[model samples]
Target: MTPLLDVRELVVRYGDFTAVDRVSFPVGAGETLALNGPSGCGKSSTALAVLQLRRPDAGEVLFEGRELTTLTERELRPIRPRMQPVFQDPYGSLSPRHRIRDAVAEPLKVQGRWNDTDGPTRVAELLDRVGLDPSYGDRHPHELSGGQCQRAGIARALASEPRLLVLDEPVSALDPSVRAGVLNLLADLQDDLGLGYLFICHDRAVVRHFADRAIEMREGRVTSG
Candidate 1:
């Protein structure tokens, strides 16, 4: 079967320094593919390149069979909603000034899908889907616990109705006690939605248990799998 996401010969650079060099991987639908490595091992760099947030200097990022690297920013706008990101810092991922509901609703509004009649209901459903109470939507990021904030972030990502999620150390910032819950939530989401995940993580134990398959990276190179 064709992979949901395919990256081949990927390279990312910062001035004279190369962060990711000639890396490649494929993530299938409803599968979790972990980029496992230590800090500065280029896992995050690969995520950015795949999202086209930082365009790759070399290689191909094929998402649903379309090449993303060659697309202009405007051309990528519509596609962006279909592949969302959930970052490590939950509180930081959300706007401190905005209520949780607003943050979750922003994606739909931006995509021109919001209708006053049902938009509020959709946001509530997303929050509930991520295991957050709809009432929590009235609160700001700072008002919620770390795990709650992260759930809110997931709700925001789901609002985009993404097919693939680029999770950049998504559970690393939360307390260990809360990590499993978030991981389990992600697993359930994948099972229910058939979503693909590019899970970037440093903890081998977590990757081993969470990922369907994993690629090990070191100093910008794929060292093992």
Candidate 2:
């Protein structure tokens, strides 16, 4: 089967500083590939490069067999829906001023698909899908707990019906008890939605519980161990 996403010898650098060095991996359809490493080991950098949020000094990123490195931002617009990301910090990612409904619907609105009548209903459905109460749509991000806020972020990521979701330390910010709940929720979502996940995390326990395959990184490179 063809891989859903492929990274070949990906190298990301900031002037003289190298953040990601020659990392390569493939995430097959419906599989979770975990990048396990300590902080600043280039896991997040690799993900950002794949999403074209950061330009790589060298190497290639292919989504569905097309090279993303060669594509302009305008050319990448349509493909953006295929590679949605759920960030590490729910609070940092969300706009404190926007209601949950607006936060979840922002992607759709940006894509120019929002209709006044159906937007709220769709937003509610997404919130509910991620285990948030539909009624919480009226609440702002600050009002929700960390886990609930993360759930809301997940809902927003899924709003685009993405095939591959880059989950960057998704459960790290939650309390220990809340961590398992969110991790299980992610596993369930992957199983039910047939979504591929590139799970970037430092916790081996979480990776062991949720990932299909694990890749360990050190000093900006994939390690043999």
Candidate 3:
């Protein structure tokens, strides 16, 4: 069966510097794949390339059997909802001025699916889904703890009902105690929602606990483990 997401010979370059060098991988439905490596090993670049946040100089990114590289930004817009990202820095990813409801609903709004009446209700549901109370929706990122902010980010990512979620060091910044809770939340979300995850991190222990399979990267190339 074809994988839900496929990356073949992905090479990302910034001028003369090669960030990701011909790395290839596949992620199937409901499967969690971890990309592990030290800093500047292209793990984040690989994720960005898949999300099309960073255009690859060379390679093929296929999502649900369609080649994303060939699609124009306008064409890729609809597919964006099917793929979402949760960045490492929860504090930076969220807007300090916007309330949790607005932050969570931003994706839907950008997709032009926001409703004046139902948007808040849906936002509340998502906040609840991510382990935050509906009342937290009134709070801004600054008012929440690190874990809560990350939960908000996760809620925002899920707002689109994405089939595949790319989590770039989703729990790396949190305290050890808080990390497990967030990790458990992710696992529960995956099992309950059947969401596929591309969990990127350098921490082997976290990756082993969170991912079904782990791929190691070194110097922009996928290392054989």
> Compared with the true structure, what per-residue lDDT tens digits does model 3 show for residues 64-156?
999999899999989999999999999999999899889999998998889999888899999999999999999989999999999999999
lDDT of 2 by residue, 37-152 (tens): 99989999999998899989999999999999998899999999889999989999999999989889999999998999998889999998999999999999999999999999
**Residue range with the least summed lDDT across 10 consecutive positions in model 3:** 216-225
Clashes of each: 0, 0, 0
Runs off by more than 4 Å, candidate 2: none
Which order, best to worst by lDDT? 1, 3, 2
Q: Candidate 1 or 3, higher lDDT?
A: 1
Indicate the residue-level lDDT of 141 in model 3: 96
lDDT of 2 at 140: 92
TM-score of each: 0.99, 0.98, 0.98
TM-score computed on alpha carbons, candidate 2: 0.98
Give the lDDT of residue 139 in candidate 1: 96
RMSD of 1: 0.6
Pairwise TM-score winner, candidates 1 and 2: 1
Q: What lDDT would candidate 2 get against the real structure? A: 0.93
Could you give candidate 1's per-residue lDDT for residues 50-117 as a string of tens digits? 99999999999999999999999999999999999999999999999999999999999999999999
Considering every candidate listed, which one attains the maximal TM-score?
1
